[model samples]
Target: MRIYPIETGNFKLDGGAMFGVVPKVIWQRTNPADVNNLIDIAARCLLLEDGNRLILIDSGLGNKQSDKFFGYYYRWGDHTLDGSLAKLGFHRDDITDVFMTHLHFDHCGGSIQWNKDRTGYEPAFKNAAFWTNENHWQWATHPNAREKASFLKENLLPMQESGQLRFIQRGDTSFLEKSELGFDILFVDGHSEKQMIPHIRYKGKTLVFMADLIPTVGHIPLPYVMGYDTRPLLTLAEKELFLNTAVQNEFYLLFEHDAHNELCTLQHTAKGVRLKNTHNFDEIFS
Candidate 1:
């Protein structure tokens, strides 16, 4: 099996929102903010190539939104989803599965695109089955007021409309063991309802796709949770449990929202689990 890092692009978000109640004095040290008090964020996706299946985890924000809509996010850089795929000698059609960690726009917006006629939306990965859990599917489709803005209809409806949408059946256990994609799903509800974090066993190491649960290295601390989360207290507990397990198992965390750092391992520190080492995709695998 081979894993590739697909960088869609970078965008800026309010540092305050990203780090919740954590003071700017603390978080700014690791994730320095710009003059506008916004921090850089990457829509970093992962591509898993195993035998006949090429599974993509999380499609970044696509370029379908209006200029006015995009202006709010302050997107930067030359990277794009199609361009990244082409660099790896692959195309959208080569993807057999799109495993979405959640349905937030930045994470799954690239799942759909405007058709040739620009009349309506169409699946971005024409040949891939778009994957999301049943609980998340319902929560996203009928979003609450707080998360409604992040779950855009344009990013979701196309997959369902194209008849390519699929759900990973949840079980009584914490990890779903029967995914055909060859990864264990870790469900956490703090960030959103039933957010599935993929625990992939690759090359003698367990590489976890750390979606929004642990977005960046700066978010390693238990108290440093995102303000966007519906239940901040729940997030604290979830992070603590997940981090302890990650440290014990020596898992390589594949970050989705960190711009500078791609992968990291944990070490038990006086302050609890902290980042041990940072690495790029190639460096870790090589």
Candidate 2:
């Protein structure tokens, strides 16, 4: 099995919101913010190539939103979903499975795109089966007031309309029974309802796609939770347990929104679990 880091694009978000309760004085030291208090963020996705299946985890924010809608998050850089796929010798239609960690626009927007004449929406990955858990699917479709803005109908709806949407049961180990993507889904609810983090066993290493559980290495501290999380207390508890397990087993955490740091390892420190080392994705694999 081979895994490629698909860097879809970069965007800026309010640093304060990204690092909830944590003071700017603290988080700014790591993820330094500009005068506008906006910090760089990457819409990083992962691609898995195994046998006849090509699975993509999290399709970055597609270029379908209106300019007014995109004015908020300053989407920059030359990277794109199609360009990144081509870098790995593939295309959008080459994808067989799109494993969404959650249905947030940044994570699943690329799942749907404008049709030829730009009249209606269509599945970006024409032949792929979009995988998201039943709980998350419902939360995104019937979003609450706080998260409604992040869940856009244009980024969704089309998957079901195209008859390519598939829902997995939370905590079900059998989700991968029929797939070639040798991975298991780890469910966490603090960020959103049942966000499925993929625990992939590759080349004798356990690499976990750290969805929003620990978005970046700066989020290693249990208290550095995102303000967007519905249940911050639950996030603290879940993160503590997740990091402890990650440190003990030496798992490589793959960041989704971190602008600079990509993969990192944790160690048991006096201040609890802290980042032990950071490396690029190719370092371990190459």
Best by lDDT: 1
Q: Please report, as a residue range, the 10-residue window in candidate 1 with the lowest summed lDDT.
A: 172-181
Reference-based TM-score of each model: 0.96, 0.97
For every candidate in turn, the CA RMSD to the true structure comes to 2.1, 1.2
lDDT of 1 by residue, 131-206 (tens): 9989999999999999999999999888898999998877533222343344788889999999989888877889
lDDT tens string, model 2, 1-286?
Answer: 6899899999999999999999999999889999999999999999988878888999999989999988999988899999999877898889999999999999999899999999999998899999998878889999999999999998889998899999888657675566545588788899999988899988888999997888888889989999999999999999999999998899999999998999999999899999999999999876
Candidate 2 worst ten-residue window by lDDT: 173-182
Runs in model 2 with CA error above 4 Å?
Answer: 178-181
Clashing pairs in 1: none
